[model samples]
Target: MPSFHNGAVEIAYLDEGEGDPIVLVHGFASSKNVNWVYPAWVSELKKDGRRVIALDNRGHGDSVKLYDASQYDIAMMANDVLALLDHLDLERADVMGYSLGSRMTAVLALSQPRRLRSAILGGIGIGMIEGGGPGENVAAALEAPSLEAVTDPVGRTFRAFADQTRSDRRALAACLRGSRRLMTADEAAGIAVPVLIAVGTADEIAGSAQALGKIIPGSEVLDIPHRDHMRAVGDKVYKAGVLDFLSRQD
Candidate 1:
């Protein structure tokens, strides 16, 4: 429940275990518990004698929401995390982010490359940029008064989809204005550190998972056979792949 004063925004995070510090970032709207606490990453990393820092981004979870859309951009979001690292006086740490969190992770790599020992970005792609709000059909449904707000079955379903695909309202709103400037395949190529991007075979988000891995040298592409974006975290192959990537650093 503790918080850190990271610039104008205060970030709430879980600081547990001990050893090489690693930060876990969840998708927008989803709390640390939803995206990661259920996953084996925390226990798996901690079991290997490492510290885990799971963050609740502004406007979500236990953290205070930034009413201003501008504050929700990836650059600002990354800074909130950097400030947390500064407050803790740590120089560098490995970062792992899913969906919206992955966009922030990319920004961290670009803006604060020195602070990141490595990174893991999941559930995203350059293909998303081509008129990537919801599809034309869903936009109409989203416009309906009943669908505008979350808390309903359709809204709940969409919320999960959003989390898995970086569709948080404020975050996406910011993205429309280039607030969450996602990197192109070429830009991502500049990042020299070990990076991993994985997707589930059944995920409608992208037709293929292998396409991304081929773009980043030394990067591995993994597909969870029966899982979608929402269920990928629970797959043994997903966990094993990510854990193996991180464990290699030691």
Candidate 2:
């Protein structure tokens, strides 16, 4: 694991393999290892001869923990990715993100399109515009004294995940509260880079992949059949579609 500072925040990351670069961003309460490495995403992409880079967002994983809600704005998180690219002295690369990371990737694609060769948004869909995923309830769950104290179904799910990940609950709570901003439909429509929006057919958290695809001009959608939000991350169908999408870009 290597790290660099995005201003005062230290971001921990892993860089592996070679050839064209592709950065991976993980979801809420997830570190790069748990979200990408454990799922074999790093290995799979590396096997395809890509330089795979993944980071722990501020307040998650081995990155510096920040308890301030104001510090976790989506743009601020997105800038960390930009900072990583700058640190590596690379001009542009493919960027892929899941769940919360998808939101960050969308911000980059819209605000910094020139920095992305392509964008792969997994575990996210129309929610990018419609604005619904983990909410204050999930934040409250992170703040709760214990996982058993959380009664909200969705909240409990996230709380349990945070515990399982051994993440700093307070820092994650602040991140959840601050990173709730959503992109406008106009913003989504403004993305010009090659984009692939992949969501599980059974993912209630991701909204609709087709709806988002229609909003982003020339964007493609991939449906991971019968998989739910959590189960869909490592699905074979999702990996195949992403690889196919990347191949077409080249």
Candidate 3:
């Protein structure tokens, strides 16, 4: 739970193992422990002789919380990732993210390609760049007075999960507000780095992984059949694909 300063925000991070570094960014309302530790991602990668670094993005986990919508921009959050790298003195590292984290990964790839050795984007697909994902509903749900008041199924589900995780609802709502910016196909295509798009075949929220893969040069898609957005996060197939991909890079 070591912390660093990304401007005014305090980012909490975990650094473990030793070798080529791999930075793990968690999804919305999830901390480094929930997204990577309890899921055994840190141990799994460490077993392969790789260093693992995970961080709590602003407004999530033990990091500084901000209610201002403008403070939660994905680009700014991406810079938080970069600043962590700088803090650790790493010039480049392989980065992996899920859901909202994937959007931040996209921003990282687009703005700081030189800081990444490779990128893995999970729980996201073409929908991220197509201008519609569950941000508004999820935000409203988070800000709702009660979970029972959230009528949208997707929103209710996310709200329940956020409650379960004990996340900061107001900060999360701000995160959702600032995270609506989407990347165009041309923007995604402009990234020059090894990329992996991992999504579940049954995930309606993820859109088409193949479509996104086709746009990013040297990108590959790993589809976990029979898994949806919630179920796919720690799926064995997804983990194996990611491990294999990382192994190939070494």
RMSD for each of the candidates: 4.2, 0.7, 1.0
lDDT of 2 by residue, 120-164 (tens): 999999988897778999999999999889999999999999999
Winning candidate number (lDDT): 2
lDDT of 3 by residue, 1-250 (tens): 6999987789999999999999999998888988899988899899989999999989999999999999987789999999999999999999999988998998998889889999999999998888566768888999999998999998998899899999999999999898778888999999888899999999988789999998999999999989998889888999999988988874
The lowest-lDDT stretch of 10 consecutive residues in candidate 2 is 127-136
Error of 1 at 20 (Å): 1.4
119-142 per-residue lDDT for model 1 (tens digits): 887765443232232332332333
Off by over 4 Å in 3: none
lDDT of each: 0.68, 0.95, 0.91
> What is the lDDT for 72 in model 3?
83
**For residue 219, what is the lDDT in candidate 2?**
96
By TM-score rank, best first, the candidates go 2, 3, 1
Between 1 and 2, whose lDDT is larger? 2
